[model samples]
Target: MKLQEKKELLKKTVYEMFPDAETELYHNNEFQLLIAILMSAQATDKQVNIINRNFFEFLKTPEDGLNLGVEEITEFISSVSFFNNKAKNIFKTCEILVAKHNSLPPKTIDELTELAGVGIKTAKVFLSVTEGAPYLWVDTHVHRVLNRIWIVKAKTPLGTDKIASKIFNAQDLAKLHDTLVLFGRYHCIARKPKCKTCPMLPWCSYKEKNLD
Candidate 1:
């Protein structure tokens, strides 16, 4: 089958499996969402949500985060990995948001990345979720899934992001941003993917199919 044909089939199968897939991180607003994503670095959604369950209640706005300061923020998110740095970045980002953006998260990638902890991937995720922007952020799961499915041949997530951008159009990116992440996270897992039950098993290029 052609590359486009494979891509379409993959998309159809993933969408059917997870039609309601979205960011599992709990947040009430854009500020909380950005903070949650920042803290989610090297952490799972369940981990972040566990901390944010109480942290977010005390932190609703930029001013709230700014007021919490680094020490208090660190205290709240101490359970997460690299809590100290994340706390500092969250404080600095809140400061910038309050001082420049009128306590609102920036709308553009350039502006968003200018914040303390927001990188290209983080910015893409934020925009894709908040504004319905057509940006796909390739994390480890996405990179693995794409390579296994023969959709992209790259060693790193960054490389996969670049190649997938060239292959998939804007609409596909929007639809895929969340679905692909969910598909890779839950279905095409890293250690032992559900290959036997996977709809794409026929076309999958992954050599070590756990069919047994």
Candidate 2:
């Protein structure tokens, strides 16, 4: 099949499998969403949600985060990876949001990335989930799936991001991002992919596909 044809088939299958694909990190609002995404760096959604369950209650607005201060913030998210730095960045991010952005997460990538912990991936995921922006947010999951499906051939997620953006239609980028992440996380997993029953087995090119 043609490349675009394969992409369409892959997209349709993934969408059918996970029609409600979205960020697993729990957040009540965009402010919390941004903070959650920041904390999700180097941490799993399960881990982040564990902390956010009670942590988000103490933070409603940027002021709430500032009120807690870095020390307390660190304490709250101590279970997550790089808690000290994440807490410090969250504190600074809140300050910027309150003093500059009027307590709203910036919608544009450039402005969003200006915040303390909001990198390209974080900014894109925030916009894609919260605002439905047509951005190709490439994480390890996305990077793996795209390469396995022959959508892109690159050594790094950043390279995959650039190529996938050029290949996939802008209209499909947001859903594709969510779909591929979920697909990679659950079905097309890194270690032992569910390949025997996978719908994409026909199109998948991963050498280590678990056919057993």
Candidate 3:
């Protein structure tokens, strides 16, 4: 199938399979979501959730986070991967938020990325989820699944984002990201994907090439 046809098919199939797809990261508001996504880097949603359950109560907003010392935050999230670095970044980010944005999370990508530990991907997550910004937020799951499905052949997440943005319009980006992440996590897996039962198997280049 051609790229356009494949993209349409992938989008339709995913919408059918998971019509109400949303982020798995637990957060009641934008601030918590941003923090959760930051902590989720190099860690799983389950792991982040496990730690956040206890940690979030103490730090829901930038002001709240500012009150929690970096050492205390580190102690709270020590069980998670890279707790030391994440804690420090979180503290610095809170300081930035409190000082610059008056304890409110910035809505734009530029302002969001300006915070400590916030990268393009993290900013994209906040933008897409919070402000309803249209963007293809590429994570490991997005990069892997886009390549596997032949929507993008990039070797890196940044490359995948660029390629996907070219093929898919801004309006479709948030849905596409959610769909691909769900597919990568559940169906189009890293090893031994459920190709036989996968809806995208017919259009998947990885499955055709015997990569899955």
Candidate 4:
């Protein structure tokens, strides 16, 4: 299949399989969502959700993060990777959101990335989910999936992210990130993809497919 054809198939299959595809990170508001995305860096959704399930109960706004302080935030999310740095960033992010954006996450990538700990990917994902922005945000799963399917020949997620922005259509870009993330996470996994049962195997270009 051609690149566009494969993209269509992948998009259709993933959307059909996961009609309600969205970020698995647990959060009730954009503030919490931004914080969660910040924390999710170098971490997994399952791990992030494990901590946020209870942590977010009291953390409803920037004032809540400010009230808790970095030390308290660190203590709250100490179980995950880079908790120390994440704590400082989250606290400062809340500060910026409160001081400048009125405790609301900015919709534009530039304004969103102004917050501490929010890189381009995090800002894009937050905007994509909250505002339905059509940005092709790429993570490890998305990068790997795209590369394995011969969609992009890049060594890094950022490289693939740049290429994917133009490869996919604007109308489908909003749904592509989450749906592809689900497919890559659950089916076309890094270690042992279910190639034998995968419907995308015919179109997959990976040389080392696991049939067993």
lDDT of 2 by residue, 2-107 (tens): 8988888898889999999888889999999999999999889999999999999998889999899999999999999999999999999999999999988988
lDDT of 1 by residue, 1-212 (tens): 78999999998998899898788889999899999999999999999999999999999998998788899999999999999999999999999999999999999999999999899878989999998898888999899999999999999999999999889988778779799999989989999999999989999999998986
In model 1, the number of clashes is 0
Q: Tell me which of candidates 1 and 2 scores higher on TM-score.
A: 1
Q: Which residue pairs show collisions in model 3?
A: none
Candidate 4 per-residue C-alpha lDDT over 90-128 given as tens digits, one digit per residue, 9 for 90 to 100? 899989988999888888989988889888888888888
Model 1 has an lDDT value of 0.92
Clashes of each: 0, 0, 0, 0
Model 4 lDDT on a 0 to 1 scale: 0.90
Residue 127 of model 3: what lDDT? Answer: 83
State the TM-score for model 4: 0.95
Stronger candidate by lDDT (2 vs 4): 2
Clashing pairs in 4: none
Worst 10 residues of 4 by lDDT: 3-12
Off by over 4 Å in 4: none
* Winner of 1 and 3 under TM-score: 1
Give the Å shift of residue 38 in candidate 4: 0.5
Clashing pairs in 1: none
Error of 4 at 80 (Å): 1.5
Error of model 4, residue 45, in angstroms = 0.8
The residue ranges of model 1 lying beyond 4 angstroms of the native Cα positions read: none
